[model samples]
Target: MTQTVPRASATATPADALAAGIGFLRREQDRAGWWKGELATNVTMDAEDLLLRHFLGILTPQAAEESARWIRSQQRADGTWATFPGGPADLSTTVEAFVALRLAGDPADAPWLTPSAEFIRDQGGIEAARVFTRIWLALVGQWSWDDLPNLPPELVFLPSWFPLNVYDFACWARQTIVPLTVVSTLRPVRPLPFDVAELRTGKRPPKTRTPWTWDGMFQNLDTALHAYAKLPFNPIRKAALKQAAEWILARQEADGSWGGIQPPWVYSILALHLLGYPLDHPAVKAGIAGLDGFTIREETDQGWLRRLEACQSPVWDTALAMTALLDAGVSAGDEMLVRATDWLLGEEIRVPGDWTVRRPSLAPGGFAFEFANDGYPDTDDTAEVVLALRRMGKPDHLRIRGAVDRSVAWLEGMQSRDGGWGAFDADNTQVLTTKLSFCDFGAVIDPPSADVTAHVVEMLAAEGKTGTRECRRGVQWLLDHQEDDGSWFGRWGANYVYGTGAVVPALTAAGIPRSSPRVRRAVRWLAEHQNADGGWGEDLRSYRDREWAGRGDSTPSQTAWALLALLAAGERESEVVTRGVEWLCARQRPDGGWDEDKHTGTGFPGDFYLSYHLYRVVFPLSALGRYVRGGS
Candidate 1:
């Protein structure tokens, strides 16, 4: 079983003057409409996948080609890839690139390909490739026979209510996993007449007993799942698989995507092909073709920078940008704020997602998306938008205010019995699902996470939810969630630093006194956690290492987060503040941004992390601009 990590010590609260500073921030928002910048998913992983396709001479459109190239160009000389700069290189990503470049027609003897293959061999060669990577390799017969886990396309034959039912995985995983089940069962490895000398594992892997064990990480689970394929099954299972395939087809998003994510698309396309469907198959063709839209093309000095088919969430972006602008002293009716409000208004989620499961009574009209995420249902967007609008000058800015109020009402109604909020669903108490061996994940349901709940608390507090039963409940929830060391677990951000930063402002905004015992402890944690460079950063590894929970090798965006949290906690003249500001200013790139190589956000603990492109700009500008103007 997984365990929550230890928290850091909470510090003493500061004097009352801190209230004025927070008020300055809250008061500057546009009439309670929420907004936040979109976070880009793991670029390294996402990019390498695109490059692999390109390397195969698949020849994506010009834009996608450039993006894939750009991603490949960023590959460090070490022949390894990382989600963020200077972080540990991931094996799966490296292997993906090695194969992609080889497909791009680069000879294995090429200078770059040599080191890349060497690195892969050193890391266990083809044996170490992730199941997903192996599946891709199997597509082209790059790997040998009998080595892959058997996922007979016949699984299209299983029922919904069974133990390994189709819907058991999280929505994100389900989309990809469902299709893969079909593809693997068929086991169609395309003929690779060309040399794959670099990809050989040097030997076939040994078979194993007891394939089920969470102790082995995601890879071990792959081995186990493959082992289960050898077992016998009954006739009743045959009908269920058909139902699942039908369900999969029916739920395809309007944009030809499932859950607005890529993995499912790739897997689904492969699976359909294995199911006797050709390239002309409607679902297969649309699925393969839709990815082109997600590519982001950027021209670089070296040819072009290529990207993959991933989403872009602008609705969330506008909301967060508005908040940053407001905090920087832009008042009511500010041009930027108005434009942001308009953008957010256009981006609201009118149709509910699976979140409606916990909230049957609430209407489907809520959620926000960055332009990229397009139509995936989400909660943080609505919550943050509420905070943004509530801070606007006109108490009666009808349109934005109406949306905020409606969103607030919807958000309030969705709160779980636990007194906190979840991102997509509530009362996700199906803990039994997590206990299953195939479930190599943390939680299936979107339970009340620290980040989502804090966003709700922050929004409601801005809209004068202060001291109300809801406010108190939310505040108490945060207080209750705090670890003995005084920090809360940041379900969404990288580590405790994110949890701590979010809660301090929320509690303070909800009328918690500057000196409240709870408030005091959170502040002290931030003050004490500052790095020697007068900045703050927490490694993504902190998700695993409790001791280094909120520690990172100082960066601008993180420093801004720490400073913002400290300022919210009423520490104006603290030495940490001066040093944070100095670090940001000193490191500001000529393009008016900071180089944030650290992954400040989490996707799934130990599975993925995000390097938000805008976090470097907006968060620092909000903090630095405020400090420049005599912020607390």
Candidate 2:
């Protein structure tokens, strides 16, 4: 929707901004008692969605044309597509975008294809692309399974105690690799309408040295596994394949998705289909139905539109939206807040998941990222949900009370050995796993992170768990992990601005004095980093380079994050706070919200970025309200 705000007089205060932003947010809330904004990522999702539909023989001309239009419009003037906007051209994204366009009937001699294909050839061609891309190519007979790394289904049988077991992978990666094992073992290849040979460099890529470095060792292992597959089908191999099939079936979420993310849901469908599950089978049918929910269609200001979220974030979005509304002084027990509480309570996971392998005694009591994904209830979302419930001030409400108690217990159990919390599992910080076998993209293990841990600490403090041992330990962990520049590392969000934003507030809630040296240092870091335009922003590149941390074009979401941090640190009356609030007010549209073009959310650091559409609106509202109320 087009967002516009009333013109502010020279005497306009943060109060005026808060009212405008809140009004805009209230209008945008869904009728279902929750909010769900666009979770935008790269064009790869568009390209991959088309590829999956083609593989299943369900691609429609309309669907193809709509997706192709989105993909083509995203291409840079130089004819290369980037993984994130304004970032360098990525060969993998370019290749995928080019192939999707070709399938959509774009001519081989099309202006974009010529340069994109040349870019692919210049970047070492198909052989140099990431493993996941190569795997996708293999499915359509464009690349050979033999050229890809090996992922044995037998790995499914590895015990939790064993190194490199299936449980060692983060929940998302596990869901993806398990079903993938079936696809690679069967080696099924469905040829595409066109070949991409012209995109390839004539020469073969070099092999890793046999002596075995980190990546080289995996390469050698893959070579040995390849040779073993050629010998014969062993009884053990057949049993492993069966185990994999059952494993896939067992984790399917009640909403019909696997892991609540696109990668696994699509792969699971393909894997089950190859295992003889027909289109009409209940599991296959449900999986197909779930995919439709992730799709989004709307009319952009530029005209027609088509896109797919890499994943949904209803639970996460609802929790934050409720919190932002309440923080902006939405009445406690307000009908909308009450309804959101009911929906959140209904979504809680009652069954144990892979997390049980680590915390065997803990009862299930957390929330997932999407509407489904019972198998992976994340700590980040759980913490935020608990805080949102607390914000309602309904301690006497039985359902809210029950949920808070159970979720708090679950969060405590999920905490790592170091007193910090990882998003999914405890002690899942085995860094060596990243170099082992067929894992090349994104974080492989769920390790303890400062940002996630801080949220839990903040939640605990709010519940009067501040003096408790667990809370104290969590507070210390945050201090121990603080960077020299007084910033914390953002594991789930973008850069130092996100890390500092998250940690300072939690620390303040945990009884850290605003005058304390550490807190003061953090407040200073934020003040110093404010952009020339009186706002704050940080690029995804900060994940890789320390110098880029807390530096970028001003954005509403990141600006709000900074504003909240300053307020939490007792700097509400400071010049930086005033300037930050003014920046948000100046950018507000007539409809009472803000517009952001930069990708502020982080998925896999430099490899992936997100533009949370509601973030630009909700956060600024929350920040402005807190400023008007006189404290965080």
Candidate 3:
């Protein structure tokens, strides 16, 4: 059921709400000059943290109990856990959560355990779980390693020019696959305290049909690889293993994570340990400490519970916060704004990373999503940081001018042949990587996305380069990709609302008339989709099902996204804009922040999602600020 706030008269006006928001943001800023909110995801992060600890023989009783408390609280009444709130129960997530509870000392006959086991059986038991889940089971000796797809360490030897080379995979996938290759080859197993036979059905899983296509070919390749694994040894395998270990070690960030992400961080530790690195080794120890930093322990109404973030977002959050405060009319010279701008300038990445493979000669100038992911500075963060700096208007500061120039050049150099931009690399849209049987889970490749492209276009326009060849090409890409209903797909956020919100502003700023057919059509779509209570939202399901596009219970962040696009298209006087502004003002919390539980941020579209806790504040503040400013 869609949630609706009563349409009572809003007690706050746009100006009043904007002031409250600005004050709220100022209070939240770090003394060091950035603002970072919690990045929340599913229970898999907590579950996986426990599993890693268990494998490392460091699963303390107190830690297991605390994490289990959080995991159990997330279970649905139907005795299953969903990847996102109100989403369908996921077979893999439920399987992992159940096993984590068992490790936490829950008895097999416990009330919670029995129903979850039953749900697992009804959902095809362990056989139906995702490849990653099965791999986890295999690590704990609950499943056979032979049934899982093989990822040979020799993949590290493939040159950049070769198909399916490590670079062909998305940066996140590449970081994970490299370390995973080492683990798969070692095939280490740790014994579980108890068997989970009750969770399994009595019948063997049926073989899936693989037609004569890319998937079929990869399936055949996997079979051949398994046959090869059965050999006593291959002379080249030792060299491949050594090379893979070196590659993993070389990429460990200063914070002791590979790419500042959970999957690669844990897998890299396991890979190194299996290859004979002890727990106390500097690299291994640092990786463990890094994960400890990602842990979040809080006192809930039920009790003290612990959860883990899949990744951190200090750089991304700070950039958006700066933009929001600027939109709210904070002076650039204000102490807080000046501090944030200086901090962002210091965080600028000057070293080349994996992106250099495609743009070997382009000078490095970008920003990473985390505190220290120097190996993978993303274009999305770089774009947003540039925009915020430009908005701050420090034209006389040589440092700021040089940073913006280098970033704009870097962004232009990273453009793909399609005239669009992916988050990490240029031309990283290889379909074969996603087709690999080993990649049956989340996205394995980073393709150009509408949201990322629109941000770049808007950034370029703000830099007064709207007519540059690169900028024009990006605008054309957005025009070509517009959906039939006038919305665009948001690969990095919730469906069409995020995409349309981003594109309309970029188009208008790039000198496309507000009266253009495309702009008017988008305005019509936003007006048509407004909820009865006067807001907007789109479910994560929109990625997989068209019916859910631009339709869901209203959320502050999503509603703000819609309002931004409408206002950009000269809808400041429209009733749609009025109601959206009112919805934001009516819902502002006592502290000026907004309460949002829905996962509007996208990780892998339908397969994975994120709830950026700051989205609720930053987006609405930006929209309300512009609304009060007569849409600028």
Top lDDT: which candidate number? 3
Cα deviation at 396, candidate 1, in Å, is: 8.4
Steric clash pairs (candidate 3): none
Kindly list the per-residue Cα lDDT of model 1 for residues 19-112, writing each as its tens digit: 2323433443345443333355545445445533433335556545455466567688776676555567777677777666555555678777
Please list the C-alpha lDDT of all candidates, in the order they appear. 0.64, 0.85, 0.91
TM-score of 1: 0.81
Q: Least lDDT summed over 10 consecutive residues: which range in candidate 1?
A: 1-10
Q: Per-candidate TM vs. native? A: 0.81, 0.96, 0.98
Pairs with steric clashes in candidate 2: 4-589, 4-590, 4-591, 5-589, 5-590, 5-591
Better of 2 and 3 by lDDT: 3
Q: Taking the tens digit of each residue's C-alpha lDDT, what string does model 3 give over 568-626? A: 99989988899889889998887889989799999988789999999999999999988
Regions of candidate 2 where Cα sits further than 4 Å from its true position: 1-12, 210-212, 300-303, 393-396
**Cα-based lDDT at residue 321, candidate 3:** 93
Q: Arrange candidates by lDDT, highest first: which order?
A: 3, 2, 1
**What TM-score should be assigned to candidate 2?**
0.96
Off by over 4 Å in 1: 1-72, 143-168, 193-242, 272-289, 372-375, 393-396, 429-445, 466-470, 589-591, 625-632
